[model samples]
Target chain A: MTPEEEAQLKRARRGRNIALALVLIGFVALFYAITIVKMVD
Target chain B: MTASANPALPAEWRDFFALTKPRVMSLVVFTGLCGLLAAPGTIHSVLGFTAVLCIALGAGGAGALNMWWEADIDAQMKRTAKRPLPQGRMKRTDARDFGVALSVASVLLMGIAVNWLAAAVLAGSILYYAVIYTIWLKPRTPQNIVIGGGAGAFPPLIGWVAVTGEITLMPVLLFALIFTWTPPHFWALALFVKSDYAKAGIPMLPVVAGEAATRKQILAYSVVLLVVSLAPWWIGGTGPIYGVAALALSGAFLALAIPVALRRAVEGDAMKPEKRLFSFSVFYLFALFAALVADRLILGQGALS
Candidate 1:
């Protein structure tokens, strides 16, 4: 593959990884919050 | 080209996001939120947000699965040709896996965070849209939108169940209202975009039933939608706030539908009345739901006893 195409692929992968990380983090926080709420109730 | 085939460009996160059909998701979220807010009794705000989030995720999952299933069909249509699956930005298996993951996650989260009833309905909605509507009915029958309407109609019912932990008349009426509203709403757009379905070989009402019959059905459904929209008020599920709004909105809906129904199909002139009806139908639904919430919150009307 050309260097430019390789760079584009890397960029896309990096972006997807970042997004996945954020979503996972958010899911963890949401579950934590729900647990706290349920316990309180 | 299938996703397995090498593509010129790599897929990005945004392509994956597009698979969710975010515009349609917005309406789903809105109606679902309206249902939650309009229901009797207060829920903890955190749980409420979780419920809506689950609804959105379920919808997104269903949309992804739908795109995965209909990639070939979408490629043939003008409107859906740019989607991730169609454009070869993503693999079919990737979309399928993503959809399955999201659907399962949403249902489990909802069951844990909210109520099992809500989660069950959410799961059903996803399956209804992804499996029943997209896979089974859409390609096979012209009445796809009519039956498939139940899929979109589930959100409000699910939302209401999230709060009450049980199904009731008000939520059922909300379900019926959207179920009836879908035909006129979809048929109007179908009237204008008749060629899209024909080109895709999908059996949309306009393609299978012809423009004349489609128009008549649009009017017939609109009339039914009017009655169904007001049934909530008639049944004392809501107050005059919703009643008046429903009456005015549905009256206008009927008015717009009448023109589209009566007018002969013209080669040109941009199908102004049909387009107008389509736009109004969307607005009509948004306003009607907003009125339902306003009736409960602003007018101090509680949920039905």
Candidate 2:
């Protein structure tokens, strides 16, 4: 692949990683809230 | 325009996200949340959130798959030409895989996390939009939106079932309200974008039946929608607040539809009334659902179960 194509791939990968991290964080927060609610109940 | 055939085309995160049709997902999520909130029972907030999340994801997945199947048709129309698949920013196979994965994951998660009934409806809805509507009905008949309305109506019903664990009158009413509301709402849009459908070779109402016939049908559907929208309150399923809001909103809906129905075309822009009614229809659904939740919260136990 050309250098520009390689750079594009890298940028795409970085963006995907950030999106994945945000989703994971959201899941953790949701699960934590569920646990707190379950404990209180 | 030739879709990029390059195997090396790196799909951006935004392109993948666009495949989900996030704008459409927002409405799905909102209606689902409203249904959850309006239901009689209280759920663990986490599970409630999860149910809405699943609804959003399921709707998104279905939308992605619809775009995948309709990519060629979308390419033909100016309105949809800029979509990720049509633009060739993402491969069709990648979109199909992403859609399938999300659909399966959402349904399974819903079943494990919430209840089977909600999950079942979610699965059904995903297939209904992706397969029945997108692949089958849309190209074949002008009645596509009329029947396909059921798919969009599912989120609220699923949300209700997620909380109540069974189908009931109120949720059924919610479903019917949207189902009935859709023909008028979408037909109004078709009136404006008739040329787009013609170019795409999709048999939308205006293209098949002509603009006058489409306008009359819109009026008829709008009338039915108005009556159905008020059913929740009349049946004692919701409180006075919702009843009042439904009355006012449906009044506005009918008022807007009247001009579009009577006038052959607007003087300045033929699409003006159609556009007005179309915009108001979205707000109408949101406001009506919001009122349902508001009534339930404010009236406490006095609100009907």
Can you give the DockQ of every candidate in the order shown?
Answer: 0.67, 0.59
Residue-level lDDT tens digits of model 2 in A1-41: 66767777788779888998998898788767766765776
Model 2's DockQ? 0.59
Model 1 stretches astray by more than 4 angstroms: B1-10, B301-305
DockQ-derived CAPRI band for the predicted complex in model 2: medium
Q: Which candidate's DockQ is highest?
A: 1
TM-score of chain A of 2: 0.94
Q: Pick the candidate with the highest TM-score.
A: 1
lDDT of 2 at B293: 91
TM-scores of all predicted structures: 0.96, 0.93
Residue B60, model 2: lDDT of 84
What lDDT tens digits, residue by residue, belong to model 1 across residues B1-305? 43323565567899889989999999999999999999988788899999999999999999999999999999998999988887788788899999999999999999989999999999989988998899988899999999889998999999899999999999999999999999999999988888888998999988888889998998899889889999999998888999999999999999999999999776676899999999998998999999999999888744432
True interface contacts reproduced, per candidate: 0.86, 0.77
